[model samples]
Target: MSTTYKVPIGPVHVGLKEPVTAWLELDGERIVGARVRPGAIHRGIEFMARERNPIQVIYLSERICGICSFSHVLCFIRAIEDLAGMTVPVRGQYIRTLVLELERVHSHLLWAGVACYTIGFDSAFHLGMQLRERVMDILELLTGNRVNYGVATFGGVRWDVTPELAKAMREMIRYYRREFTPFRDIVMDDPIAHARMRGVGVLTGEEAVRYSATGPTARASGLRIDLRKSSPYEAYGDIPVEPIVPQDHFGAARGDVLDRFAVRVMEVYQSLDVLEKVLDGLPEGPYAAEANLNKVLASLKKAEGTGWGIIEAPRGDDTHVVHLKGGDENVYWWKVRAPTYANAVSWPLMFRGNELADAPLIINSIDPCISCMERMMVTDGRGDPRVVTRAELLERCRRKTFDMMGRRA
Candidate 1:
């Protein structure tokens, strides 16, 4: 006698603006099987960069996603800079590190809010968002814009954080102590939160290692590979690093939602620690090598060769590859492999055999960036799931408008 029946979860709700679906076989509300329906939004962000010119492409990179905008630019710029055989100034590197860490704080807080919402803790969601707003404010003050801050440019930064902003980082850290510590205690130490999470969705250390997971996911599962330490891009190598590990960094890494959550919480603190060190020895130099637009354009001279650059983006490792061609409009091929590529692979393993109730918890635990994930469509029958996207709908509207025209050329 068998009592397992299929119960579908997601195309996640408003709690997470990302679209995702999980098919779980349930035995009276207990999950017996699971499958992650991810291809819903693979908008082809990966291959799109190849079509645009390098200088003209920074803006397109910015549109990759609002939350991880700077990191996207950082990755692409690092790749292009490597191709040009150029190195940014030491001060510029420090500035880039600070920007990256600030973005990390911003992103972690945003994830905290979304996680809270997924778990139905609305108050915590609002609190996390409010604190997250502080980091966003800092970004705007330094970058001259909110969201897609175009602060990173090849060979260096587009803008500098003045003395005023440097001071603000210290005070803001103090304010965040009040906001994050309490929230951290509740999410990390509270029994209720633990009951909801804890061993509910356990990804063993071996599984995490075998899957090649990175960032907090791997860290949570006890995989110790933060690219900052291993690869040491930018100036992370210059500053000392303390792993935001569980069980005090020496214990066996826990591959669970709580462990993943705790690693991220502690990582925010470590980011601040790194930034303070970078600032203490912040260098001084011109951001980009060229002094004027003509010089900058001339610097992009197409060379016949191939190269690659890899950066530790906020979500994880993001790589960019370039193959120079003699006359291929600036360069030959620019390829980027964002962290999501590896992160998504772990979803199936994470969700499988987990209870249907823990779908959201596990999905967000990998922290799949849907905007980064791209296209979203409901692939199941009887759902009448309006599988229309803004592009398709707009194209249809444009087609109708052209057909309605009384005169045509």
Candidate 2:
């Protein structure tokens, strides 16, 4: 006779850095079924955006996900620009592309490191983070901040990359190119990594499409859909981007963890090449228009249209929709759909029929960012359940912000 039981992984787990509650149906070491519960850390960003002006909303969007902060802000700005029928200068477009690709490099490197740590390779994880610092430093130099990178605004970027900064970025790219071989060898060629990752979380191309997966997750399954390639934005139209599929380096698509890893590493190279092209063809013009906030606010108040923005974030497509009220500076309504939300449905499919030990790696392979999910649950350790109101949560967040700022000062 066979016995089956349920195992709950987390709202918190040793293997996962973020809170994702996964319920697995296990028969001994193998998993027969799986269900993931997200929304443990929702921040209600879209609702809050209705209270802020367009300028404030840009910064608000960045708080959605730290790893892909630039992607969110860019999408929000694009939506605002489209609504107002504003034109960003050619130079501004190139600058946005530069920062966007730099963020991609940083995000992928971070994911690679996390993947190593999840599989119990500490040395490789440290090395990946050490290399990632270079990208962070470049981003800090360009945007004045490393993580949030508050660069994009309504019509154009708030800051411009100087010629010297551009030179430094080129040098950084060259250094990364030279160092990539060893990094690739460690992650791709290691026998242990191959044994652990290959064929572990296989999601077929059909499954990926059905789930509406985007970014590396979809491409790893041989789906040729990249917003940069299929739906060009920013400077991507000026410099074409070719979609990188898993089969290019892996020979054939298995749609497994290994294929996702290969696709991300391959994309680092592609992003580097695209960065170089943007730099070489960068035009000369004003980086940002005049900062007349009152005028901008007046225009926004009078504007009564809906705008949609979609961009390929490091993980996948990040979309934002904005509806401007006819007589208010604040937005009437706003909605955000992150890639993780789309991929969340596909987790059960990947987790089905996989070993319990492989669960963490498979979950992380999607680059799941639960922070972007608009849900939150507060758990009290006692036997009794407690009800927390939304006002209380918002106040708690505000207090934390003040405390953080006070500490910084």
Candidate 3:
């Protein structure tokens, strides 16, 4: 018998691009053990509240991640609204939900593209990206920007939807469904696809619960939990969120790559269902509250207050924690959290015993978006540095003199 050798996966390399580092103790082809460390993209945004006002905070908060920015701003505003006792108009709620769903569609589509690319399926990846362009167009038309949709305000939305605009959105979505149909088949119904994914990374329900996994990772393990249903935010509470138990769609996956693929395809349909409901229920009124930017800023002169908000980000349940203490000083403590926190914790469980080559596929299952919000280590990794991973990003990063660049090849 040959002696088992260890392998180093990251801390800087590309192809499987990510800032996350993993040390795999391998006995030949089998993983004897694995060590994970994340946190390469820490921005120290947590303490910026002491220097920024509530309005200015929105801009800073949007810096979290392009994909999760809207959710980040929405959750933060919700928390501040909770403290200020601000109630958005009925119209605002509907618009907020619409914008979020659009964001949801955008995020899922982007991931679908990335997921397809992860497995070397470029055709599916291009289709996903092509379809995502329509979603971005819708966002740009409605919110004036795509990715970081700054459409959310503390008490309401920054934009409004008209009948013509709504009709335009409907038309665009219908057209994209045509593209989604063929690609969905190519990814989901392909036998080879299942062979690669179906039972590859099997994290059972019990293990998922023990690890406190949330979002798709937990869903793949057969857990039926969605913050939209339990917490009831925006229009999701009013919209139908049927869990695709034996099927896939933001619900459960078989804890494998294919299961992850299936979840995204189904979510596309569910998101459309939500958009229809929002359009039907949207009430006519002011899109945002009349809070003066300057006055609101002045009122926020209070030295300190603590607030927190949670939203279902594209990757999973994104959460934010805020703390402030009244003082004359220019620095106040503010903390931000992302869904990557929960998903990152679940990595070790998924990686253990998995084959060496399967590491990227397994990590992609969480659709981990390590760059969202801020990266933090709940607890320190044994002796090495922390490397963040989320949303199927597996490119090993290489640090250069001027910058850390991901080498995908």
lDDT of each: 0.73, 0.87, 0.72
The positional error of residue 30 in candidate 2, measured at the CA in angstroms, is 0.4
lDDT for 149 in candidate 1 is 84
lDDT tens digits, residue span 6-105, model 3? 7777656453445666777888787777776556666667656657767778878888777868888888787777655677888898898888788888
**Tens digit of per-residue lDDT, candidate 1, span 68-119:** 7877787777777776677788878888889988988888888877777777
Off by over 4 Å in 1: 46-51, 249-252, 374-409
lDDT score at residue 373, model 2, on the 0-100 scale: 61
Runs in model 2 lying further than 4 Å from the true structure: 375-409
Please give the distance, in angstroms, between residue 111's alpha carbon in candidate 1 and its true position after superposition: 1.0
What shift in Å separates residue 255 of candidate 3 from its native position after superposition?
2.0
Give me the overall lDDT of model 3. Answer: 0.72
lDDT of 2 at 152: 85
Task: Indicate the residue-level lDDT of 244 in model 1.
Answer: 61
**Candidate 2 C-alpha lDDT tens digits along 1-409:** 8899999888899988789889999999999999777656767777788889888888898999899999999988888778878888888888999999999999999999999899888899999999999999999999888899888887778888888998999999998999976998988889999998999999999999999888899999999889998999999998999889977766898899989999998999999999999999989989776577788778888987778899999999999888786788897777788888887788899998899999999989999888886543455876343566779989988997698568545
In model 3, what is the error at residue 53, expressed in angstroms? Answer: 1.2
- Candidate 3 regions off by >4 Å? 246-253, 302-304, 325-331, 377-409
Q: Please name the candidate that would achieve the greatest TM-score relative to the true structure.
A: 2
lDDT for residue 75 in candidate 2, whole number 0-100: 89
